[model samples]
Structure formats: C-alpha cells, structure tokens
Target chain A: MILPPPEPQTRRQLLRGAAARTASAALAAAAAPGAGGVAPASAAVAVPAASATIDRLQRLVRVELLLEYCYRQVLSSTILRPDARRAIAPFEGHVEAHVAALEARLAARGATLPPGPASVSQANRFLARRRVGGRLGHLRGDQDALRLLLSMEQVVIGAHFVALLKLSEPALVELSAQIMATGAQHDAVLRLLLPPHKLGSAAPYGLVQGVQ
Target chain B: MVGDGGGASRRALLGAAAVAGLALSGCGATAAPASTRPAPAVAERDLALLLAALELERRTVAAYVAGLPLLPRALRGTVQQFLSEELEHTGELISLVRSVGGRVPARPNSFQLGHPSDAAGVLALVHELESAQIATYLSTIPQLSPGPVRAAVASILTVDAQHVSLIRLQQGQAPVPSAFVTGAE
Candidate 1:
C-alpha cells in the first residue's frame, strides 16, 4: 500500500535535516586539504547513429517486440497475483501498440518488420548475467517481476533518447520523443513500487541517458 | 540552475541585430538590403524552438506558483519539487536561446490556469500541464538539429513525462496513460 503523505511539521523537519546534511557535506569538502586540486571528469557514451530512418525504425521495432515478448512470458506465470496481472496487462498492451505504430511506419517505408529475438524465452536470460554466478528466475515473485519491468522501461527510454538524435525525419523523431516520455512515466511508476530501501525516489537526478 | 551571466549581453546584441536587420530591409535602394536576406533556415528554426521552449517552461513555472498555494500541505512538496525542475529547465532554455542567436523573450504576462477549489483540482491542473509540456517537447524534438540542443530538449521532455506518471498515480489512475505518446501538435 502507498504510504500516507507526511504532515506539514514532518515536512519542515525533513527539509531542515536535508539542509543540515548539505551544509555538513559542504563544510567537509571545504576543510579537506588539497581536495580542490583534483578535478573530477565524466564522459557520456554517445549512442551510435542509425544508417537511415528505416534502419532506425526497424531497430526500434525489434526492441518493442522484445519488450512485449518478455511481458507475455511474465504474465503466463502462475505466481503473479490477479491484481499484478491486471496491472501488467495494460503495460503489455502498450508495448503491442508501440509495435503496431512502428510496424506501420516501417510498412510505409517498404521495410520489413524485424523478428523478435530467439533467445528471450525466460526472464533470467534477460535479467541475469554469467559474471554474477548464473541466471535466476526473477519472475518467481511479484516484486521481482515489477523490477524486471522497470528495467525494461529504462532501456526503452534510453533507446528513444538516442533515436531522437539519429533520426532524420521530423515526424519520426517526434514520435520517438513522445514514446520516450511514456516510457519515462513507466519508469517512475515502477520505481515507486519497489520497497523504499530498494528504490529511493520516483525520479532520477538528470535526464536518463541509458541505452542498455 | 545558475547561468554564466554572459547570456544577457548576448541576448541584447541579438535583439539589436534583429532590429537592425528589420531597419535595413525598409531601405528602398536598387539592390536588396542586407537585412532583406533571410536568416539561415536552420538557425531560424532553432531560434523559434528556443523561444517556444522558453514560453512553455515559464508558463509552467507560473502554473506551480498559482496552483501550489491551493494544494494541501502534503501535496505541496511534490509540486515544489517539480517546480524546481521547471525552473532549471527555464534556465537551460534561456542559455540555449542566447547560444542559438535568439534574444530573451518577454515573460508571460499571465498564465491561463483556471481556478482550483481543492487539492484534487490542483493535481488535475498539474496533470494537464505536464501532458501539454510532454507533448510540446515530443513534437519539438524532431525539428531540432541533432546535437546538444536536441539532446537537452529530449532530456527535459523525459522528465516531464515522468511527472505525468507521478500525477496519475496520485489520482489513483493507471500510471501508463497510453501505449505510445502521440504528440498531435
């Protein structure tokens, strides 16, 4: 269940605590000798540009198919509660809608729709890595299923963010931006469902630029 | 959200350049005046986009200003958080305008937010505002040239979309509004 909203006094106290913490961090940073001498730098991995508009759309179509396929597999599991199934239904439906839109766009270009990946038979194959022991079935629990879905949403958001830059056609780029927005919404809601200790906030710090 | 303080002077020069361009176009000499020549389509398009984004962000900031007082204390924090983001967005857009040869736009004289009687009204208003912002950003992305400008707009657009989801959840509605976001306009 969603928690009740904090009281006004509680809100004020929380703000004060946050301010104090910020001040302490600032002071600590200032007092650290020679710390300012070192400069921090970060780099962004630029998403590769598609060869052509059709090529980009075709790649995105494959992504939607993969998402839909994963959602269908999770829905078929017996462990998911009825309410959980109900919630997931619309998400699956939305992915299908995305597939349709993408396919339509591809058809207009006389491009063939890309097939779904042959390897995405189960959730573990998608979620787990060999470096971390082995694949475990995350769909065995309702919470885990939600987490998987959240990760997919983030992946989609990152893809569209890149596509917006690569796409040459104005209308296609617009469509990508719109869909990316929805994907972000999905990310927010899914993040909220995870336990407070697991996922801290509804939104991320800056724009989510993830591609994988 | 802090700007580097150089944009104001640049924007002033841009405004002067625009005015000078217009004035030169009025001359009735035999040859076409320098101002009569159209600015590059790419540059003009970028300028228009920056202006539109500026207007959207400013109006949204105003929406929060008008709507927050009516909301319950519990809901105010969420709105405030969103407001801060919007303010950051406005700052970014202002810098972008100067970067793209556009002058600072006149701030909105008034926002069109309707009266809200309660917390629900405030949230509903927020939902509408966020949806509009999301749509605008989506539609605008295609028009932007591929580079930092487009990337910046997309980044802000994604955040607005997230805001829509959060607002829907508060209303006990499904988080996903639709399968695909369709930016009609």
Candidate 2:
C-alpha cells in the first residue's frame, strides 16, 4: 500500500506561525480603537515590530546551531569518500561561521542565545521533531550523506527567505540574504556531487524558495 | 522583449495586477482614505532597483548569446542552460517592475561585453558578468522594503551565486570559496 509521506518540517512553517501570531496581535490592537478612533503613533508601533524582529533572529540562531551540529556529525562519519570529505569539510566551517555571526547579532541585541543540541541523541531529537530523526545514523554511502546535507542547506535557504519578509532592520535583512546565498552555493555544489551530476540539476530553477 | 516571450508576458501581467492591488490596499494593512495614505515611495524605490537588475540580466543574457559559440562543445550545454536561467531572471524582474508601476526599460540592442578569444576567455567573461550581477543584487536587497519584493530579489541573488560556484568548479577552483557570498570576490 502507498503510505502518506511524513509532514516535512520547514522553517517556512515556523516563520509563518510566528508571523501569524504577530499579525493577530496587531489586528487585535487595531480592532480596539484608540480614543476618538485615532491610530497609535508610529513610535508606539515601532516597539513591537522591533521585538518581533528580535524574536525571529533568535529562532534563526537556534536553526544555525542545529545545522552546525548536523554538519559536525556528517563530517565525522566515515561514509564520505576522502575527496568528498575534503570538499565538504569547508561547509562545516561555514556553518560555524554562520553560528558565530548570528550569535554576535543576538548578543548585540542583548538576547539570550538558544542552546544547541549537545549530543547525538539531542540532535536526533531535534531532527525527530521535524520528522527526520535518526538522519545522522542512516548514512549508508557518500550519496546518502550528500543528499542529507543538500536538504539541510535548502532548509537554511528557506528559513532565511521567510525571515527576510519580516526583518525590519535593513542590515539584518542584508546579512540574512548573504547567508542564504551561501546556502544556495552549498546546495549547488552538493547537487553536482550527487549521482548523474549535471549542471542542469545544479541550478534547476531561477527562483529559489528552497525545499519549502 | 528580453525573455522567453509568452511566459514572461503572462508573469508581467500577473505581477502588475498584484502590485496594483497591493498599492490600493496599502500593503494589506488597514486602508486609510486616499488623502491620508502615504505615497508609494518604497514601491517606487523597489521598482527602480528591479529595473536596474532587469537591465543587468538582459546584458548578461546577451553576453551568453555572444559567447556561447566560443565555448568548448562540452561547456556549451552548461552555458546554454545558464543562459536560459538568465532569461528567467529577466522575466521575473520585469514582472516585479511592472507590478510596482514602473516602466519596463527598453532592451539594449547589444551590450559592449568584451570579446573573448577562446573558451577560457568566454568563461572569464561570464564569471565577471555573473559576479557583477551578484553584487548588484546584494546591494539592492537592503534597499528593498521587507516583503515579497525583497524575498524575490534574494531568491535571484542566490541563483546567481550558484552559477558562480559551478563556474569555479569547472575552473578547478573551490566551488564555494567563502562562507558569505558578498559577490565582492
């Protein structure tokens, strides 16, 4: 019997939920008209908007941390070929850099850093919440590992795309786009290393909304 | 005039309608009266950026057309595919510009892209053009308001960066040399 596919865990979903919550709160405020039906000043609106951006930034930090954990796991695995290992080792460093940049941003905002997965079991639990648990342990070959990494990179791209929509600060939006573009580069390179590697698969679409 | 014809036209129509609607609705927020509503300066700025990006995309498309024959037989297919994607980017940008009530700029009859002597020269020219495209999008993203327009620009930027990575791979260099795709390199 054909079974239904598990619901994919997407950062788009998380961001959408966050956006909905923010929208609902705004709507609630709007529904309750101020004295003489006058709208609130722009300064009053700015506070919540700034806090929402911070919340989104914090979520992205958690995502980067989890991704860093996953990258470390795959790098340590013996399933990858030596050449593949050499090519992909830099990606782990990239993810670490992403984490560092995001953490610095959070610290600048005086936001607490979200704790990352500290162990393999913790990482698996994190993945399981997204319905892709035991991913690190499932690697049978180089292709498997590469495919997993490709999917992860796509997730990063999607997350940043969603975050960009609500990010108020232009600098933060620019930083997010820069990071997202790096994820796309990683996606393309990983696709080239996969089976039946072709340039077409490396860049199959002009618009990258990511796996979501 | 610079894209895959019918598809680009249809997308342009849809984009125009969507942007007009967005403008009318004050970006999906509570609509105040026309006099009280603010001017669409943000949309105009986005339109300008999209138009500039569209112009660059058109030139990049032209460069691929001019340089395609100079590439090696094995590399032609890849470059051809990249050409098609560049056309797609133009179509998307055109749609965005139209949606924001901006005039679609006239496509240049020809670009003064430098002549490449051989396959290596062609690759170098393509790389230079792609890098410039990447840099343009990176700078443009921050200026765009936080919305679908910014999202769309980011999407296109990523693809351009991907093209660069593949080109580097073909040149036997590191596919992704940097963690951040600043496009300055």
Q: Encode model 1's per-residue lDDT on A17-37: one tens digit a residue.
A: 554566566557756887663
Candidate 2's TM-score? 0.78
lDDT of 2 at A190: 88
Tens-digit per-residue lDDT, B1-185, candidate 1: 11222222323333433443343231212121212333222345687776887677766666665566556667677777776677666666665665556777555445556655456766787788777877777667777774456766787887777777777777888767687665321
- Give chain B TM-scores in order: 0.72, 0.75
The C-alpha lDDT values of all candidates are: 0.63, 0.73
**Candidate 2: CAPRI quality band:** medium
For model 2, state the Cα shift of residue B125 in Å: 0.8
lDDT of 1 at A125: 54
DockQ of 2: 0.56
Residue range A60-82, candidate 2, lDDT tens digits: 87777778888888888788888
Show the colliding residue pairs in model 1. Answer: none
- Docking level for model 1: acceptable
